[model samples]
Target: MKILLLITPSEDIVEKFRLSLKDEYIVLTAYSFEQGSDLIRPDQINLIAIDITISESDKIKSWFARHRNIQDIMWLGIVSSDISEEELGKYSSIFHEIICTPISRNRLKIAIKNIQERLDILSENKHLKLLSIAYTEKERDTESVIRLSPGPLEKAVPLFRTFTASLDLDKLIDLFLDAVTDVVGVSRISFLLYNKEDDVYRVKASRGIHPDISSRIYLTPDSGMILWLSTRGRILRRDKVEGDVVSKGILIRAFREMEVLQSVVGIPIMYEGKLLCILNLDRKITSEPYSSMELEKLFILSNYFGKAIQDIYKYNIICNQKEYTQKILERMGTGVITVNEKEEIIIFNPKAEEILKEKAADIKGRPVEVLPEPITRLIRETIRDKKAYNKHEVISEEDNLYVEVDTYGLYDISGLLIGGVILLEDISAREELSREKKKGENLQLLNELVGRMAHELRNPLVAVRTFTQLMKDRYSDPEFQDFFFSTVTGEVEKLNSLIEKLIAFAHPIEYKFDIVDLGEVLDNSLESILRAVKTSNIQLIKNYTPGIFKIRADNKQIYKAFSYILQNSFNAMQSGGTLTMNVESVLKDATIKISVKDTGRGIPPEDFKKVFDPFYTTPEKGIGLGLPLSQKIIEEHGGKVSVSSVFNHGTTLTILLPIAAQTEEEV
Candidate 1:
């Protein structure tokens, strides 16, 4: 039967052709040129017919020109219009017959019948040529070939039995040689294996062949027969291929390289569709050439040997991986323990054994009860819920150990929980460091507090002393006495207020959360600093968004924080400069951003980082608790204070706070 492929844009043509040829041919159809090009296999289809109008004639010609391999096949084109004699001659190479649209049924049938008959005659003649070559060579009787071996398969039993018991590739190759020796009088055997990294084929095993010949044979792209075997992956013989063009070209050159003029068989060993190696065997020069049956049996054995070598390579890889993994676990600092689904320990690394004060050999494969209570509980939780537990600290009083244990369930790719893994990290040193840091911070805070108190009190005390002296000297004067009393009372009140603020700054006070408007808070702070701004000839600019920007914060603390920031801006602008305070709400981030920009001399880059550190001051006077305290208050109210300065360009201090959803009355 013949295979016919029809290509056209019309579906009706494909269906009608398929029905007409249903009894005599296997019909395949494609709707586009691209689909037809992919379906054209020279070995499968006998004829190809393409239907195109005048517009797509050039497209089909280009497609045929590019695929020169399909040019050898029988191709016919159907056109929408009649072709002129000159144009037909021009396209004669692309299409054998150019038929017109609405084909004549009788003429098409007659043409197809002639084509089929011609193809059948050509196929038969090709088969006859191959048979003629086969008979010209020497042949052996069937009985004589069969008597040479008891059974080729039965001889391979020992090799198959040793496959599981050994991991030696060389021993398997030796066994394969012995199995094949009974079928053919083997003189020399050479195994050439391909190396992927080097891109070369080297002789791996050899016998009865010169060591120099095997060592010098490195198959590259230019290597004639070796490269052919790598690509074709077919069994080749010297006698049977002398008449064939392609095979003769490869085998004749390969035969010249052999030391002895005898029959040689080249078998390609394949695995996973890749040519892994080539097994070459040479029969004695005096003996008859190997029969077709023997050569076919050797090909099968070559495939079996390839699988054996592959298995050994994989086994060694797995063994190396295991060793590497074990070494890593031993050197790791963190303790590792793995338990199977039965709660029995499957692995206990060296660190785990050292931390727990137990031997790995003694506890491995033991129940979870072998571990301490805390670790046992963590493992149980992970196994029971099939989840991970992390960052839990455990302390062993008897061993004086403090460790952080993280547990996780080990699941396979299919999501089946197969085990649990626990990692233990020693954290005793970390805990000690934390305690010392806290102590240092507290001492520093105390020192800053004492300095602030002294600085605040000295001014008020000096004023009181001066007023008391005036009152003592001028007690008889009524006006002077009234002025002295009033001055003294004001100084005393200022002293009281200073003390109250110092106490609040130095201690932790319970904060009352309420809906406080940030804009109002800034206004109040600006009012307090307005006097300082006027005295310094500084201009103050307040740009507040027209909205009630409220936040859930301690009203008193936020006010204090705003006041401190305003004071800093006043102090920085010693000369006449502009201090712009801007307040805006960022609704997307749910925050209120307050920026206090000043045009005073910018802070030094080195001093910017320490501006908010307690007792860290650049000015000669005053303890530097103002900015630090402001930052602390804002942080306590769930806000942040950031300062950016560009040397001589002045500084900007911005405060961000979360916007409160409640109104002022909701407080």
Candidate 2:
């Protein structure tokens, strides 16, 4: 039984009450009301044996009233024998039980024992309430912290930016480790990236520890803890190890090497069901084991980190591909132009700029068609094909330029066609080289022919001159001498004609320009050929669409050029086939086009190109200088000639000429 005996002044009576209750129960005594109040907390007090006659009685009664509100302590009051029943009645509302002086020992024992039983029940209820309040407060604190905690997702922006900006893999790994260390509150962190090619895990990033320590650390499939965690793709904690294998050798060695006397946590970074790396963190600076809250945060952060790593790797691959493409473009002799779907040029490389004699800066955003005609044609072809096309040796007759163009389709990741790229190469130099080679070969053949002809003609001419002189000297008849002189003059004229033809074949035309109607020139030349071949029963067909077709030309030279082709057609139709002539105007470019076709034995395919070489001949009487000289004349007028022939079938020749100055006004 536990009893609280409050003995107050009126000092003699207080001592008497203490002596009575001290033997019967575990007694607690307070001598004053102030002392009594201090001792009467929930568990410490049960029965109050007070001295009723004391001046402090009302004060003690007030203290008992305040304690009653607490509901955990039993109150009993002590009184003097002189106290009246009415006085006891007045105080009855405050005290639960009251005892008078000169009380029996048995009565006091029973009272004290009864109070002790009540106190025991009260104590139990009080502790239960305290626990409930404590739990609620603790939950509130945790919720507050969680709400305030920087979420794993919040780091993504900076993490992604940093990861993508770093080119070096090691530097990227280090940044990832630093972010992990900051989040997890870990004292040390390290990253072990798996090298599938080597079949090993190499430590790549470390914090709060020297890299030398990481260098010394190595792991393989055979390594127990590392292998188990990596294979399971689970978060592993040092304290959670279950098996003897984890407890005995490998774990011990790892802990010792890492100098982690406290807790350790490891998480595997998995991508596409394959283990990519391991993230390891040691106990924090305070050596506290990682809390459940922190571990959960790490789990979320790791997911974000894994995705960021993949993005960075993908970005790097794209950058490297761009670099490789640039290198390839630089190495190529051709020019490259790339444009987006909007038809705006984007990638105009140095070679493309140089060939066009234009800068990328001046034309990048311009429409593709706004570029030079050659480039525009290439762009259009690429768009039409949706694949690569190679156009070799496309000659621009107006510019006298030859270029090769190769165009390819550009595609994106999903194999969707995006745009097109054009590769341009100037093949004019190569064409010129081929022409020179042909000229050299022809010159060699011509020199051989000329040497033989000259040797044969020189002796005959010398004999004729000598015979003419001898006749003049020996003949007495004047008429005979005159006939011998006439023979001499005829031989000299034949020799002079041969020499003039040789000179014409050897020299290229020198330009002399004047405005002339090419249509009228063609008409006059065809008329002359018809007259010359009057005996041949060839039908001449004319499909002439007359417009102001004019060009700047050396009129006589151009006349000769037209006459040579007309004569050739007349000669081709030896059995009198049809000769067709056509003329048309090109309005967009202000040029004229003329076509001449012969239904006669055509030149062979092999001889088409060779027919334009100087002195090349097929007919016994033909000299190839005619076609070659005609080509030179047309070119000098900023025009071009093209021929298509099928052997023994037919032949067609076309010429393109710029409009002359006088024709511009009429058009």
Best by the lDDT measure: 1
Question: CA lDDT of 364 in candidate 2?
Answer: 89
**Model 1 bad stretches (over 4 Å):** 1-152, 157-167, 182-188, 195-203, 207-252, 260-263, 270-276, 284-289, 307-456, 460-498, 511-667
Give stretches of model 2 more than 4 Å off.
1-183, 195-199, 242-263, 284-293, 350-372, 384-391, 394-403, 411-417, 426-460, 474-667
lDDT of 2 by residue, 536-590 (tens): 5888788763345657888878887898888777778888788889877787987
Worst 10 residues of 2 by lDDT: 129-138
Listed in order, each prediction's TM-score against the native is 0.48, 0.48
Residue-pair clashes per prediction, in order, are 0, 1
lDDT of 2: 0.69
